[model samples]
Target chain A: MSFEPITGRYLTVSVEGAPRRIYVEEAGQGRPVLCLHTAGADTRQWRHLMNDAAVTASNRLIAFDMPWHGKSLPPEGFETQEYLLTTEAYIDTVLAVIDGMGLDKPVLAGCSMGGRIALQLAALHPEKFSGFIAIEASDFQPAWYDIDWFHRPDAHGGEMGAALVSANISPFAPEVERWNTLWMFMQSGPGVFRGDLSFYTKDDSLIARLGQIDTAQTPVHVIVGAYDLTCTPEDAERTARAIPGATLAVMDELGHFPMSEHPEGFRPFFLDALAKMPVATAQAA
Target chain B: MIETFTHIQSQLDASPHLLRLGRLFSETVLIEVDGDEYYLTFDKGRIVQVMQGPSRKTPWRFALRTDAAALSEFWQPRPAPGFHDVFGFVKIGRGRIDGDILCLVKNLRFFKEVLGLARSKQEQAA
Candidate 1:
């Protein structure tokens, strides 16, 4: 059986100053959620969730190519995960897209790298969002991260930028190996490596800065695949622990992508997370 | 306020002690519910000093005038309770406080208890 997204496309937008083509898709509406992808992958990671009743019944979900991959191409050398994932640049592109759509602060949801961006976005500008949900966010525990692994010698981070690009954002990848190949391709691109490095070796102090997100009253959902090695189960707890009153749900027998690996697993949690946001908002006062 | 205090981070309310140990507070903590700030000194995630900020009664800055003696009386480490139990405390009156208060959960595992899986499928296969 092949997985397909209900609404999908290679769209374009001029946000974060540079005009970039972003792979995009939009479906349903109640609340809006900006879906984020992993370092090397495009929005395809969230493809399974689009048709999910939990998502469709409660909110509008939107996802697009990050600056350099998919339909949105960043500069040839925009390799700074620090820059690509910075709250300023990341927020600018998202807000631009939001303003482009004229919607209020939507629930910012992402997994792994995307989750890192979601955390920063929530922290830097809590006023702009309704709530945030993340799956094993990288920035969740910045202090514990192993920075050296990102730069392993076998990892070709700089030279294959172009090939890495093609592998990452292609509209259609035929098989799981092809998809996995595309997912792993980021290690070869200079821009994505820096982005990965930025993710793994951040100085943002999210560990200490968690209290700043004010989750005691805000609804933030932190999800983790029990067997996710990329970020690991311990890392998920660290992230969940960082927020006050934030919901932490660990998927059993689940790997990296909860929304994809187990839609049955993630659905109820997604609905619950959605349900929690409004109460969080009402309670925030 | 400090004498009535307990460890009051955002992660405390749903912490594991309630499920595994059938308890919420560790024997040590006294609690204060002022406004935004939640200060705690713990032994096993038990509340020794929960210096919460002012309730809806005053502004968050009120925690500044904390009762030092009561707070100091409870600072020690014990096996932490469920880390998430602070959620209830935060929800009660501190619900709107800043995100920084979540730091008080001494041991993360108490709150981050993973629900499903006793063993991995990959392991079972092996």
Candidate 2:
């Protein structure tokens, strides 16, 4: 229901080796914001927010389909690999995008896996990202850090219960909802979830590693919907703890994809973040 | 097709409150008696842009862009903040209204007509 009056044509890029298809909307171009979608969500996830006055007024919103998820082709057998690898591969792809698009460093904004990827990319190549606005990024570990872990709906649960699990997925459409869920699950597969969970849930902790990194000192803004089912308020608090001084904006009556769910609320918040970022970063296209 | 005006002429014609506009450079008038600077532009007698605010660079005023294609086929009803069933015509790019306040309120009818074009366009598309 929340959509911006903006649409973009599709694009293909050579990230992590092969060609990947992406979509971008350039409106009232100024500085650029490279947007990454959550796991299971393509660039379409940011469709409404891209149209947000904050993004369109003074910035170009660049959204891309994660490999194997949208129009992009997951490398041969790579689809069978773990997600951490996908994240690694995706970073390379994102780097290629910056160079390919001939864009100077941009602020990286993403949600969920997209959020985690943003953080990882910033950690690895902080110079490329001028800032971060990660929303409901997955717990470095799904089991340990995740206060509420995703699971197969209890078999003992009734069809009504099963319907709840199914509905949490794609809200649109009826038939093939199961396939939709399976397809969604396959893209982020259990393997990747387990692998990332190891690093995220490791006794060692990724925050320590992230804290140690002396990358580009870009501003970080952390956001989570007040009603986020995936990343609870606690998770958001912890995220702020890890990224000291991170601006945390919580939207009411919004879910995991708050920006998409409640643009009226999220738009202003995101703009405020942009308004606060270094003027030069936001000033340049 | 409407005739296009250079600067001030365009501002005078598109504006519903022209008398209050006085001069482009002399006075920065709002829509009503105390509104923002509202301007209307026409090319070949056809209106191209209707704006309320200071200028076009970063239109703080809500500048609704429209062409003939938009005017003829007003978009069908959908849902929005101000409209009941009208989606209004889209004039490409984002709409900004900030400088003058009254300019927006005074130009609602003219804006609605242009938006009507968008509303029709949706009907054809759907």
Candidate 3:
């Protein structure tokens, strides 16, 4: 029987003084690389990256589903409250996971909401991470549509969520991967997408804090898909321009969920971006 | 143009996935290309009628309006970034959607696929 090289485990991390059981997956051996999924998504987005032998050869890739997402399961008594992710809450969780897993300044990589938080993490705790990869990320994204529509009783949350994100994928993407990306969103729990978007679309912009990022100590790499209208190439460009020594790559024929939408096409760009960060080698030493 | 609408209707009918996606979607959608109007009526996932209109009486649950050139661009097999999807069209100021947004969002995949059928028609014609 054939099997994947990846392994899954659970890590109990304390965030906000509450013990949360987080589902973590890992593959490969070398310099640790922590992968963060997009908003309303889980660690599955990193399946392609984790399974790629090229990436795994020199990296021990780690992916975890955030609390109330994927296999992580909401904290006890979650039914009574509306889920809203704040920057502080998100940061605390990442910090907890890193410390809990005992990663030695792993290279941090995230997409969309994950991407935004990477920037936040860089600004707040540059010393904790060796390098950063931000995909389809921006310091600030204006409200595109009413977030309420995502969880309305009249609308089918899963279908509507999938449809909303479907436009963000490039038409040139592989058919199976494209639908797979949408399938993840379709499986999202009701109101969970909106909850994540609360932090995503929050008016608090990270523009001012960007100056705090020291790319010399922690290399910052921003890669964006040309077809992502939601977080356009312009947004990524602006982000790259804000950080001194930050590198930017604009991938053609890709969209918001590059890693999942077409991993084969995304691999070269991701590898190239990872190559630019010598911090990985430095951390390994 | 009427022939094009008819072709889109036929193509949508032929798609079982689209039909399944729109199983409960029943509504009339207005497509206005540079002020020229075409009404598409969908019932239980099937495009039952296609009508060209400048008439005042035809009511639609939603309307998608764009210029002829923009619509043509959107119909390209691999459309440029902003012209690729209905929301992308709105984002880039190439298209406008008005009326019952809930109705449109509810069966968004269905309507999006319906509009996208024109791309295959264009491909075949080419």
Where is model 1 more than 4 Å wrong at Cα? A1-5, A9-16, A76-87, A138-194, A279-285, B1-126
Q: How would the candidate models be sorted by lDDT, starting from the highest?
A: 3, 1, 2
Kindly list the per-residue Cα lDDT of model 2 for residues A13-66, writing each as its tens digit: 776666766655544476778887665445655666666675677777787665
For residue A36, give model 3's deviation from the true position in Å. 0.5
Model 3 RMSD in angstroms? 1.3
- What DockQ does candidate 1 score? 0.01
Docking class of 2: incorrect
The stretch of ten residues in a row with the least summed lDDT in candidate 3 chain B is B65-74
lDDT of 2 by residue, B3-112 (tens): 22233344444555432322221222222112244564434334445455555453234433333333333222432211221112211222223443233333332333
> Chain B TM-score of model 3, please?
0.94
Q: What is the TM-score ranking, best to worst?
A: 3, 1, 2
Strongest candidate by TM-score:
3
Looking at chain B only, the TM-scores across the models are 0.23, 0.34, 0.94
Q: Which stretches of candidate 2 lie above 4 Å from their native place?
A: A1-12, A23-26, A76-85, A144-205, A213-216, A280-285, B1-126
State the lDDT of candidate 3 residue by residue for A254-274, as single tens digits.
999999998998999989877
Model 3: pairs clashing at backbone N, Cα or C within 3 Å: none
